[model samples]
Each structure stands twice: as structure tokens, then as C-alpha cells.
Target: MEVFALVGPLYRRVQRKIELDTARQGLSVGLRAVLDLLREHGPMTVPQMGRAQSISRQFVQRMVNDGAANGLVEAVPNPAHARSSLIRLTDAGRAAIEAAVAREHALLREAAGDLTTADVDTCVRVLGRMLRLFEDVDVNGQAVS
Candidate 1:
């Protein structure tokens, strides 16, 4: 329970840090997520991204729209789906994400001084388990009980 209580605050703090970092590169958090996903997983539909991030399809669509408007991403034909075009990174998008990731990595490496591999591994294991515990929750957030 103590760990659970700490999770929310920790998440908020980390998210705020990321938001500040992304802003320097002229990216909103949603756009940064969309770009990161496309870069990591290749082209995908908005629904796929929504599912991947456990967010709403409509929200992902909005982010994709913004990316398209900025020439960061473009819609290409999806052979499997007649409609829902795949969103892909433009050359500029690739460059932007790479630079952003490089900057983040540089900052992340600075945090390694005080933590051991085992400590980080334990945190990952605990967080992963906690997340999976919510997998059975309904969309309305009701527990199975």
C-alpha cells in the first residue's frame, strides 16, 4: 500500500520532467508519444497506437493529425485496411526523434551513479507486476472482486 501511494506522485513528477524535456524540441507530450511509437514500431494505424499506449483512439487520432499538420508524419496506404491509413515518420520526424532520444539518453545516463543494476531490475519487476494486476480491471475501472 505504501508503494502504491508513492506511484502516483512518482509518475506525475516523471511525466512533468518529460514534458519539459519534449517542449524544448517543440513537441507536445502526445505528439512525442506518437512519434516515439512510430519510430520504434514502424508505421501503424491510430487504433494500433491507442491500444499500444492504453489510451483513447480519438486522442491518438488528434495527435496524429497534429503530427501530419507539422509535416512530422504522413499517411500512407495500408494494404490491409482500405481506410485507416498507416502513419509513418517523415525524414524530419526521424531526425527530430533521434535528437530528442539522444538528449534524453544523455540525461538518463547521469542517473546511474547511485543505482545498481539489481536495484533498477527490482523496480522494473515490481512496477510490471503492479501494472499486470490491473489488466483484469474493466473499462469503467471496476475490479473483478
Candidate 2:
């Protein structure tokens, strides 16, 4: 219960900061997430992205549509799925992502003024364990592992 209490507030605070920081770069937090996903995982269909991000396919499609309008991303032919095109970041998109990442890194550095690398590593390990525990529990209240 204490963990749940901390997690919600922590997530909101972090998300708010990211939204503000990314907005300054002319991108919303969601779009920035999509950009990061594409950069990390390569071209993917809207449904694939939706699954990865735990969002709806329509929502991901909307983001991709907006990105296409801004020339930040382009739809390429998907060999496996004829109707669903794979989205890839454009040169402009990569530049925008880079700028946003730099801004985020600066913010993170300022926020982590006193925390050492070991502290961060410990936090990462703890969080990873918590995430795995959550993943092992099914939505219907069944323990999968």
C-alpha cells in the first residue's frame, strides 16, 4: 500500500515535468514517447506501437497522423501487413527527439544533484523487481508466476 501510494504521486510528478519540458520543444509528452519508441525499436505499425505503449491503436494512429503532417514521420510500406503501414521517423523527427532528449537529460541532472550512480542503480533494480511482480499478476486477480 505504501508502494502504491508513492508510485502514483511519483509518476504524476515525473510526467508533469516531462510534459512541461517536452512542450517547450513543441512536442507533447505522448509524441515524445512515440518518437523515443521509434528510435529505440525501429519502424512499427500503429497497432504494434499501441501494444508496446499500452495505448489504443486509434490513439497511436492519431499521433502518427499528426507527425506525418509535421513532416516528423512518414508511413512506409509494410511487407507483412498490406493495410497497415509502418511508421518511421524522418530526419526532422530525429532532430526533434535529440533536442527533447538533451532537454530531459539536463532536467534529470538538475533533479539528481545529490543522488550518486549507486543510488540510481539501486532504485532501478528495485523498480524493475516491482514491475516484474506486476507483470506476473493477471488482471483477473490470478498469479501467473
Candidate 3:
């Protein structure tokens, strides 16, 4: 219980650092969030994607349009809706995401050079558990439905 008092803030700090670094690389946090959503869910409508990330549909649509223009995402015909299109990451988008992930991992490794692999693994596990807990809490709190 006492350990969580330290871990929570430290975990948030790490997240903030990663977000700052990603922002410096010309990827807005929202864009990264959109990319990550697409990567995990494969393809989805703007509304669906927005809901998944707790973003507004208008915002997601704008981001998807920008991504499509940049060749990072493409529009697919939606079977369920005649007018709505599904957003999917293009090959270029996947490559960019891979590059970003590699850069992030490199940064983490440099920052945690003193930590052994086992130590890093434990940190990851703890953080992952915390993330799951946060997600459940959010849902329970009506942050998502």
C-alpha cells in the first residue's frame, strides 16, 4: 500500500517524459494516441476510434484526415455505413510507428542503463498492472462506457 504511493507518481512521470519526447519528434500526443489505437484495433470508424481513446469524434476525424493526407492512414469503405469510412494505417504509417517505438526504446534504455534486464522487466510488469487498474477505474467512474 505504501509502495503504491511512490509508484503512481513515478509511473506518471515516466509517461510524461515519453510523451514529451514523442512531442519533440513532431508527433502530437493526440496523434500518437490515434496511431496507437489504429495499431491495436486494426481499422475502425472515426467515432469508434474516438470512443476508444476518449476523444471527440470531430477531433478524431480531423486527425484521421491529416494522417490520410500524410500517407499515414487510408480510408476504407465501411460496410455498415454508406457514408462512413474506416481508418487504417498504411505501410508508411506502420514504418513510422516502428521507428518511433525504436526511438522510445532507445531512450528508455539510455535512461535506465543502470537497471538490469530483470529490473526493467519487473518495472514493466508493475506498470502494466497499474495501467489495467487505471482502465478499470476509468470505466467504473463513467470515464468510458
Candidate 4:
């Protein structure tokens, strides 16, 4: 329960930071998330992106549309799914993400003022374990034993 409580606040704080940083770069948090997803996992369809980000397909599509309009992302034909298009980052998109990331890194460094590498590593390890535990649990709230 304590861990679950922390998740929401932590997520919101991280999102707020991202929002602030992305705003300076003229990108919304949603679009930045989509770009980061593509950069990390390669090109993916709207559905694939939605699943990966745990967001609605419609929302992901909207972001993709916005990105396309901004010349940040382009639609490529999906070989396996004829009707679905894969979204890939353009050179401009990659540059934007790179800039966003650099800004984020600076922000994180400032935020981490006193925290050491080991402290961050320990936090990551603990959070990763909690994530795995959550993943194994079912929707009905039963643990998968």
C-alpha cells in the first residue's frame, strides 16, 4: 500500500518535470513520450505504441498526427499489418528528442544535487522489483502464484 501510494506521486512529479522541460522545447509531454518510445523501441504502430505506453489508442494516434504535422514523425507501411502504419522518427524528430533529453539530464542532475549514483541505483532496483511484482498480479487483484 505504501509503495502503491508512492507510485502516483512519483509519477506525477516526473511527469511535471518532463512537461516543464518539453514545454521549453515546444513539445508536449505526450508527444515527447511518443518520440522517446519510438527512439527506444524502433518504429511501432499506434496500437503497439498505446500498449507500450499504457495509453489509449486514440490518444496515441492524436500524438502521432501532431508529430507528423510537426515533421517529427513519419508513417511507414507496416509489412505485417497492411492496414496499420508504423511511426518512425524523422531526423528532425531525433534531434528534438536529443535536445529534450539533454535538457532533462541537466534538470535531473540539478534535482539529484545530493543523491549519489548508488542511491539512485538502489531506488531503481527496488522500484523495478515492485514493478515485476505488479506485473505478475492479475486484474482481479490476485497474486499470481
What local distance difference test score does each model get? 0.90, 0.87, 0.79, 0.90
Please, what are the lDDT tens digits per residue for candidate 1 over residues 1-145? Answer: 8888998897798788889999987899999999999999999999999988878999999999999999999999999999889999999999988888888789879978999999999999998998798887755576645
After TM-score superposition, the amount by which residue 135's alpha carbon in candidate 2 deviates from its true location, in angstroms, is 1.4
Misplaced by over 4 Å in model 4 are: 1-7, 136-145
Residue 85 miss distance in model 3 (angstroms)? 0.9
Off by over 4 Å in 3: 1-4, 110-145
Q: Which residue pairs clash within candidate 1?
A: none
TM-score of 3: 0.70
Clash pairs of candidate 4? none
Q: 38-61, model 3: which lDDT tens digit per residue?
A: 888898999998778766899988
Question: Cα RMSD to native, each candidate?
Answer: 2.4, 2.8, 3.3, 3.0
TM-score of each: 0.87, 0.87, 0.70, 0.85
Candidate 1 residue 61 C-alpha distance from true site, Å: 1.4
- Angstrom error of the Cα, residue 40, model 2: value is 1.4
lDDT by residue (tens digit), candidate 2, 25-83: 78877788889899999999999998787778888888888888888899999999999
Candidate 4 on 1-145: residue-level lDDT in tens?
7977988898899899789878888899999999999999999999999878767899999999999999999999999999999999999999999889887788778778889999999989989998886886654566656
Please state the error at residue 38 of candidate 3 in Å: 1.3
